[model samples]
Target: MSKPSLHQYYLSLIPNLVSELFFYIPKNEIRDDIIEKLDFLNTTNIFNTIYVVDYYKGPIEFKKGRDNTRLLLKDGDLDKNMFNLLEKKSEVPPHEFNYVLDKYFELAECLFYITNWMNTNINKMLPHDDTSSGIFYMQSLSYKKHFEILVKNFYPTKDIIPKGNFNALELIETYFPDIASQYHKPAHHPTEHTTPTPTNSVGVQEEIQPVLKKTKKPPLITALEAEKILLEQVFNVDFKKLK
Candidate 1:
């Protein structure tokens, strides 16, 4: 038999990568049919874990960019358009599978970095009274532009690959448009505190109330659910039956 080319070799690593990624999920609780379905997905040669890693870099960098926009030397430099390194396929020599494998692991770690960052940021955002309180209005536009590039340049899978019923990209797309909107939305600061209400006969001062303005709520995300969606969609493994 002919040896596997670099493309086929990195392609083969996906199933093992996915297995390790979701090792915490209990195996016995999964339905036999689901297990069979996953096995079939494992057989697919089209999808790669690299695509999953590429999808996450923008969202991760978006938060980082907004947090320290002034400090950054250039826009969107945090992740450095890491996905672009993988752009050339036909140009890479078949014997360079080891190089590709190294990059795969690096991007894999990046994916985890992004996931953990989102978990932290979402938790912090949830308790805030103003969902868009600390958001940098100008910086989020740059972030939105980066996100647009990611969506437009996404690599296509092989022609025979089946469309996944669930997709992580779709979830990210849904969550971030609202995020972009939230950041772009005007911040309403109270111009002045209302005049204190008159006290009765007593010497106590009445509380002052400020005018209220309606604000849009930030999208709520569960870390576990996000991780599950990424695993199932990126790896093409159906986990609907995993209790």
Candidate 2:
């Protein structure tokens, strides 16, 4: 068989990388199917002991994006777009999802530090000298780049979630006159400094898009009602003199 290319070689390590990234889910809460898939990711069976954590369901609840697919990141950074798509594929509960994404966000930041990802200036702290944390930092960017390519290859669109008669692309085409221009992407994918344009399903520009159906659940977000109410009450007092 032909040898795996650099991208494919990194691609193969995802399950293991994810395995290393995530640790400590309570045994009772995890479903057998998810647990099974994750368990054998590195080893044959359940050899490692599952650690327990105090119950805390994470904040990234499922909501429908403008395209009506499961929305994982509402106001979260565009870097988190991958996690939004992952909600459908993994089908894990909110808490577990939060745990993994928290881990991912910390590591994924390596992609943005185009020049000094390793903080080599302060490398004197760690054990080694020349390689001093730079190798690990380089590896973080490498893994993040490959993961992006993998997501685009597999779950490239909201079409993966499959709503009723109409799909995400068709919905966008029918409504937005300028949609065609926004849909185009470059032929060559870059290894670093990639950014997603704002769009209906992209977790930005939420107000600009129209929703044909109700969201999966209202966004798991809340604003301070007291602020609104206080302002309205203050305004109302001035008008009380008229009555």
Q: List the residue pairs that clash in candidate 2.
A: none
lDDT for 128 (candidate 1): 41
lDDT of 2 at 195: 37
For model 2, residues 1-243, the per-residue Cα lDDT tens digits are: 896443353334233333211111123333455434442322433222221111233212222221211122212323344544354335656655444443333333222221122232223323353332433344334343433333233323333322322232443333332433334555354333333443332211122434435454342111212211221222231222223
Where model 2 places Cα greater than 4 Å from the true spot, the runs are 1-15, 18-128, 158-243
Cα-based lDDT at residue 49, candidate 1: 17
Candidate 1, position 202, lDDT? 13
lDDT (tens digit, per residue) of candidate 1 on 50-126: 11122223212122223342323223342244233334334566446336634444334334433333333432433
> TM-score of each candidate?
0.28, 0.22
Residue 188 of model 2: what lDDT?
59
RMSD list, candidates in order: 18.8, 21.7
